[model samples]
Target: MAATDRAEYCGIGIRGVAIGIDSFVWFALLFVAITVTGVVTGQVETGAQGVHTSLSGTPGSIALGLWVVLTLGYHALCEWRFGKTIGKALVNIRVASTDGSAPSLGAALIRNVARLVDWLPSLYLVGIAGMVLSDRRQRLGDRLAGTTVVSD
Candidate 1:
């Protein structure tokens, strides 16, 4: 491949860094939401030892559902509308169709949804392996969605 062709594909290290940044964002959101919910619902209780937090029943269920939507929706909306997440944008990478065009919503959804499989055997072992072995450096989700993570 020519230099430009090679430049179009992002490798594992940068992708991993992008994901790490994304995870921090997710964690921060989760922490804020949980803290706010605990405060509003009085889910945090003072224990003999120290401060404690607990949630169950309706509140717990609602939190769980909302988290799922927010987590998935964050990726889907970002990819479909901008072709990249905040992390990917910061890292100067993007998710694009194999044909080098922006991915459609359906394609982006497929890519994000396939994360379930990509995470198999813990910590994306399979997905990492696939990226390392594939010519395009794609994960399972990228392959399934007919997309690639590229430098921008």
Candidate 2:
């Protein structure tokens, strides 16, 4: 809402669409990786309920660890390097510092890490609350990183 700014802050609705796209991609990637690892490591099971994996032992731990790394790294690296992930790019939005510069690597990392906290209590309620309360429509991650998703 600055006089000189052409880029407007995005709200939760469009942001939600971008996240849906990103989450679908993330889910697909995780499904493949976990399924392959589980089968290869003999950690998968076919039950009356459904086909699933026991992510409970060392193999499970490693798979979970990989998920953590991939999820965080994917968002942070993309935001740092290009200001947008594929979903955000498709939505024509980008993350930028409050001062209108590209976000730094540290900022991007903090933003993605804060996503864990924002995801708490299910369905990104915390993030939505933060965005609603913020004057610039920032989620917790954006506020923490001094970044905002903006129209491109």
Candidate 3:
């Protein structure tokens, strides 16, 4: 294979850093969204009932739903449109198909969806193990989606 055709996978340390950056970004977004929502709705009740009301089904469910959308949308759109999230860009990495091209929306969606599996038992232990074990340094999501994260 030509040097150009030989894929160079990104290492775990850098990938971890990229993920850290994305996590920080996600946290900021969630904080802002929740704050704005609370201010606009004035949903906070007073006294002991306040906590209960805030944690009750509707508001809590709405928050959860919004979080899921924001998180998944962020990953899916970024991967599809740019092959990289802001964090991935900052880290000089990108996601691409096995043949080394921009991934399709289906591939992006599959990877992001499979992220749930990679996240099993918390802190992405399964993903970490997969990346460590895989020849292309793929996490479970990447493997399932037939994609890999590589240095750009």
Per-model TM-score versus the true fold: 0.79, 0.83, 0.83
* lDDT value, residue 142 of candidate 1: 89
Q: lDDT per residue, candidate 3, 85-108, as tens digits?
A: 999999999998988889899999
Candidate 2 lDDT score at position 31: 79
User: What are the per-model numbers of colliding residue pairs?
Assistant: 0, 0, 0
Clashing pairs in 1: none
lDDT of 2 by residue, 22-60 (tens): 997788668766887798899898989999886667887
Error of 2 at 131 (Å): 0.4
lDDT of 1 by residue, 88-113 (tens): 99999998888777889998898888
Q: Give the C-alpha miss distance for residue 43 in model 1, angstroms.
A: 3.7
Worst 10 residues of 2 by lDDT: 1-10
RMSD of each: 3.9, 3.8, 4.1
